[model samples]
Target chain A: MTKSRIYLSIALLPLLSVPWFFGPSSSAVVLGFPIWALYSLAITLLFSLLLCWILQRYWSLLAEDESDVE
Target chain B: MSSEALIDGGGLVVMSLYFLSLIGIGLAGRFASREESLSDFYLSGRSMGLTVLFLTLYATQYSGNTLIGFAGRAYREGFLFLMSVTFMMAVIGVYLLYAPKLRRLAERFEFITIGDYVQHRYSNSGLTIVVTILAIVALGNYVLTNLKAIGLIVEAATGGVVSFATGIIALCAIMVLYETLGGLRSVAWTDALQGILLLLGCFAIFAAIEFHYGGLRSLGDQLSAARPDLWLPPSSAQKWGWLSTLLLLGIGIAMYPHAIQRIYAARSTDTLRRSLQIMVFMPLVTTLFMVIIGIVGLSQFPDLDRAGSENITLLILTDLANNIPGIEILILLFICAALAAIMSTVDSALLAISSLFTQDIYRRLRPDSSQQQLTRFGKILSWAIMAAMAYLAIQADATIWRLIVIKLELLCQIAPAIILGVNVRRLNAAAVLSGLLAGTALTLFLMLAGDPIPSKPLGIHAGIWALLLNLAIVFLVDRLRRPAE
Candidate 1:
């Protein structure tokens, strides 16, 4: 993916990272957490994974130069 | 805050041994030093390997606030404090915006401090001086917050056998001693140890909770039954607040002088990249556990006010000791880790402050100073700053969150300068300076106008509003400058 596209996608991740869609009236619980709290943490875990992927696959291309180090 | 001592003789022995090991590491780093140059003392000669780099970053980023204050915040705010996890990740995510570009420049320029980049990029002495002073103030506040945390941990661990003032003075002396002796090398080495302890500490909290109070499920049920307000979904204003927090912390923390210097101190780009990749997962293990502990505290002790809530972790551990046999060992381990977390952060901040003072502020006045002279001056500055912050910590009573907001508000004003300056080559120094000052003025005005004007007007933090104004001014000034050029 293009750097701009990658960044744009990362920018959108925070929207999901917050549990905005869950309303106050919902009483659902997952395991031992409120459903919204569970959703927030699940999304955060995904956020971590996706960021790791981006770092591994794209950072070398985006960074200035690698010849100086290795 | 508790009068009775919780830890007995064995725990005290473990604590003493931990302090001795840190001093030992400092001596080792002193012997390990290659030269009297500022780079050798401050950046570890830019030779930090992947393990040390990753661990030090983890240790530095998760401070005493993460363990104590954050849990307290969670207890008070409930599920809304889960925003803490998102904000922590945002700090690393924002790094992606600047770290790669900044790392390349740092290697090329041999940058010793964040001010070096500001000076090199802007080529404006006035802007550099202003940026340096802002960074110093922000970092000084960071040290102050962590110093207070150190006193709390020491006093709590000893069960008030050691007074708060004594804890502050003694730990401050030890931190300055090792930092002066070994500098970044010593600090990083100690941080690696502290990082492991911190991770284990989190796991201990999880294990203890599961063993005694059942699982998070039981705690969640209890909280819902007892304090239904906590389990309720966030309000509209809170949703807006979360988004605002994401923006402010995501961008602002990346500007931390100590964290930025870590980018310069990396052995290679690959190492830095790998380390940061791992860092993204940290909130899961560290922050999530703290949030859980806070929730557990809320469910168990429903009547705690704000100040009492901050000591909820200690309360939980003390309760565990009373119920569970042999749990005191794990509790002792957690206390050591807690101390490690607080000290690692303070030492790093002190080192950054000393470097910023000696290189950015002092060097500007006396350009003829030798590297050895500057390095020595940095050591002395660390001592002086520690003493002052120690005094302030003992006397002051502000909450950690308040200090965090103030520091980040000041630091975020400089983001356009550092973040945009790294990416946009055509960005002018005048544009950045104007935006920085305007943003800072608005934030200070709103924050200082405490009683009548709300700090988070309309549910959004004052810092985020200031940042919006800051960015708009930067864009406008850049456009005007383009026409003139």
Candidate 2:
């Protein structure tokens, strides 16, 4: 996939936080003790998505200038 | 805090010998390897693989707290302390946010400082300085917390030969020497050695305790009968608090300069990715080890007083180990691990903070400074910072979590500036500054008001409140700066 696609794919992980905010299980020891897995994954995916978009939109810079090559 | 120390002749010798060896290892790092340029200085040319990376990460992450302060928390709060284990597991997942992309970019640019990345991405010197300052302060607090642990070990194990001030000076000097000489390379290599000792020490002490107490099941039965809440997860105080904490600490702790600096230091994207994958499973081993130990304490010491709970972990281990035939030696080993944790974590912070000052702040003002000259001065700055921390350690605070939590509250405000700089072009410097100021003000207000223990409103962490306000202000101001799309 393109750079934007990759970044978005990552950022989307963080967006999962919205669902996490909804609620956790009453089964806390296995599920609720700390929210690192659920919340962090969401934030990471969200960040990656944003970064993917930026990289793709700025893709022109990735093109190598053959004439300038040594 | 009376030591209630069980140290005797053999224990004293083992502890003293370990200090000697650590100092010797610190000096050995000064023998420069046959490599050239900054990468060699900072990262040993990215030669570390999964094993070295894993050990380094493990030793770095656990630090003095696991052995010294964490058990104290566990003894005091009972089941509520397990939040530490869960949060650590969460810290692993938190890495997924930037680890992948950060690894790629770091390899691309040979980036060392998180400040450097922010500076390059945003082309803003102001942003770089802000990040560098925040990082230096946060790392400084981390060192202070670990230093207190160092003081405790020295006093207890050395029969008062090493006063708190003496221990701080000696350990800080050794750590700075090794870190400045070999950079991240030496630190990683030493961490590999130290991490193994740490794990062994944990398991050995744990087994000794369990065997003495008639095993895990019997211990659990005792705790459950006496303190049922110790076995169950946190109820009123902890459950309400975990929500904001999951987000606040997960993000804030991951932003440590050393953690991000490693993304740049990794040999390849695969190395970084694999190391992080391993990180995902570490809490199972690292966190559970400490939690189980803490729970076992409940059975051994029936009527443990609150004021003494902070010292309970050490007290119980010493008391139980003294009676054991084979385990007294391992208590000495734990002392080594304790020092290793303090040195490895603080040394990394010193080096990172120094680099930020030399590369980001100092050079920005004096662009023409020679690389050799700057590197020389960086070494000096590292020592200076360590010396300051040594002073803090002597007048140590007993409340480990308070120092760490307060520092994190202020440091969390950096997220909008550092994390958002990469993709959000509309996130103007003015907007970033506004967000930071607002967030910092809110955090300080809460802290200053002395909002009772644990949390304030809706069971949320104070940092989360500040961060929420910070982000909202960033976006609101950013929108005004560049109108609606």
Candidate 3:
């Protein structure tokens, strides 16, 4: 579920709104992986999963009950 | 021992190995379910979760065009090309309209095809069948454009060793084989691998470009010093119309039949919803990565023709390798990533078109056909369609934008029937059919009449023009025609 992985995907999201941000500072080394916008993407992805689960499950009159497995 | 021979040998090895891996992924279906269970085979048992769904959606959206075409446009156009980023992002944001509800219905109904949705809403076999086939054909052409781009870019990047027509046939044959085997599940799985490589390739090239030049800031400063106009928005000459873009992609991009089908195949509402959330911000990252490559190329290679803008990224990379110290490996990685983008899209599209034929056309006409029979038909349809596209892509001397415009024009016709169909219960099938036909006809007419929509069309894309008429007809006819349910 995205809820569980929000932290991970957020860690990977990239930023595209800015014109062009790649300077020497763009490749900030952290341990090994560069601390770039990709991290933010991963986190956002995770958050979306959690949010959708909450909204789809609890908020709306959308889903029919899963077919009985019997 | 020579540098040229050494680099050439390395590139060949990487290219050969990647090609073999793609076929193996295609063969992945043999270990999957037997052809007996069409549902399992085609829809991947409707069991994909957030990860596969997200990756598949990403892979399918980016396609070969993202690297070769969009990148090329950004290089030449500059700030106006930034709109390309916004348009793609807007597609994900628009998902909020219906994806949430659609996901729940798909799971509950156990629907594998978008036609099931259309058929249920309209209660009309004729309408559903027609829409389904339209979707298949539109998407077939969509994938074919990307396939054509792939062949062009590969041969261009490799320098004439691989002819464009031969490259298209070879790649398409690989796509058809894997897609015939694994279906949605295989596409999604491979998509995840491809998406990662795609992003890495982008970053690698970004790093390489920045490393060779000073960085983006210096590069931008250099570009600005040379041509300040590139940083500004489109002039009257460029025609980067905003409202038109909203309409163009709103109906055109959202109606990707494969995308809609993937929503149907979601494991749960949660999975579908999550996939869309990340989809919203995709432009900021993926599009940003590409547009920068384009802009950077402007500083690196000024005086490029309009078409040369597209080859800017590859051109820069190849030039960087040849002129700069030692970065041949980066070029190899770039080629791999680019090839992966093309193949990932090709396989997904092959599955989408073949599904349309098998389910919407074949099964609808002959409802009693068994799973084995239907899937056998699906495989045959897959190969046949691929062969046909290979022919069209190679022989057809149409511009890439021409193919994309025809594609969106056709896809725009289906938007009202699907997107609006979910909200309004009283929308009669006959009225919807009327609207769909009118929309398709108007779009085709307008498209045949004039300018490229994304590139320029009275300062608008043809899709926006067609969509306006599409929505207007849907509304007008829904009010005018009183068809009995």
Candidate 4:
């Protein structure tokens, strides 16, 4: 894998677990969702956009043959 | 949620017409067939373009569970089930790990079944057979689950005018007839139609609920006041479960045999790449909509018991049909979409099961069999398997989500063999074979051992633990094998 692709994957993992980091507060709401719920949704959308960018930019790199990997 | 017929005279007529159109497409697909070879039967002559590929993948991946089961889960679990959208996207994310290399290799090898890939990569007969058997069992369970859904929908839609057993038998016959007539070409064509219907269905219901209940903001306010626990952050245990679910679904679903075939069937690498890029955004529309609808149901009908919650989507629809003027048409559309979702998944799995049995097991036993003979046997196999699964669906009483977990657990065991095999050239047949066996054994032990052992220890699924062990063993075996060589 390329250094950039590896870095992107690492960045993506933490975003997937965003729900785990918040507290039990429903005191705040966003567009009909609690702060944590809405936060998780926003992070998921960001995760998807980043994945799309990775797919478009680094697809050829990811698709390279095993011989090219470190 | 009473046991009343949701569809009567005109509704029955529309549903019948929909059923007949599928068979019509089957006949059309047969005429469109290029040749009688297994390659043509299973992979559609390796000529699928972007639209057909995308729709087929979409329809095949999202089953009736996405429509009904997901809504029910959301109703029961509250917002924690929003993880449904994340896990689905994870399936697509995992696809990127190996689909590109696998697609190129499949084209070079002219692969027909997933077994063909395993056999080629490992050159080990035992490993190939084991993997194929694992795939068939998992897929067989998939067919059974969907078959039960079809039967329940028909029985409920008709208010017992057509019994559950009758529903299973009739739909099974329709699926097998179309499948045997046109093969994957017919299945993909039907899937495209079904995919469109599914999208329309989800959107219609989501709009109705959002408009009827003010908006998400209103619903959120109500939910926050009524069920404060739902708005709270996940407990530590729930966090572990969320991460575990992502691993199981992400890795397991990408390894589905029919899903692998779609990669090989693509007309070009660009077609496959574009289809998957578009798929990354589907969860936003498909799963997120269902999650919202489920929450809507929870807010509307707060007193339903656990079993009643599973039918929350149906309850919401039935309530709408009774009250909303001009909404019956939309309900009919949703019904057809639900059937489309169930039938589309069953047909693809049936085709995959037939190809695996004929190519992997039968042909291995009889090397002299020609492609014509194998294709003929595959047609016969689809009919036989569908009959057996339909019968089991009638007799069985297991819940759909439990069946889903069992299937994914078995299917995920084969991931190391396929995913690791593609990426690591030095990963040998023995390493994969040992890892697969160890993982499967551990999963079964954990699953069957009750009371003394919790089903999901520390809120993580048994399958996830087994998978971690499986991956560790694969690398360990590879390391040991290197020095010996």
Best by DockQ: 1
How close is every model to the real structure, measured as TM-score?
A: 0.97, 0.83, 0.84, 0.97
Show where candidate 3 strays beyond 4 Å.
A1-70, B1-7, B235-240, B450-458, B482-485
Going through the candidates in order, what is chain B's TM-score?
A: 0.98, 0.92, 0.92, 0.98
On DockQ, who's better, 1 or 3?
Answer: 1
Q: Write candidate 3's Cα lDDT for B414-449 as tens digits.
A: 877876776566778887887777777776666665
TM-score-best of 1 and 2: 1
DockQ per candidate: 0.59, 0.07, 0.07, 0.52
What value does the lDDT take at residue B93 in candidate 1? Answer: 78
The positional error of residue B484 in candidate 2, measured at the CA in angstroms, is 5.4
- How much lDDT does each candidate structure score? 0.88, 0.68, 0.69, 0.87
| Candidate 4 CAPRI-style tier | medium
Write down the lDDT that model 3 would get: 0.69
RMSD of 2: 6.1
List, residue by residue over B226-296, the lDDT tens digit for candidate 1. 68887677878888888888888887787889999899999999999999999999998999889889988
Query: For residues B257-353, could you state the per-residue lDDT of candidate 4 as single tens digits?
Result: 9999999999998899889889889999999999988888988888888888878888888888778887888768888999999999999999999
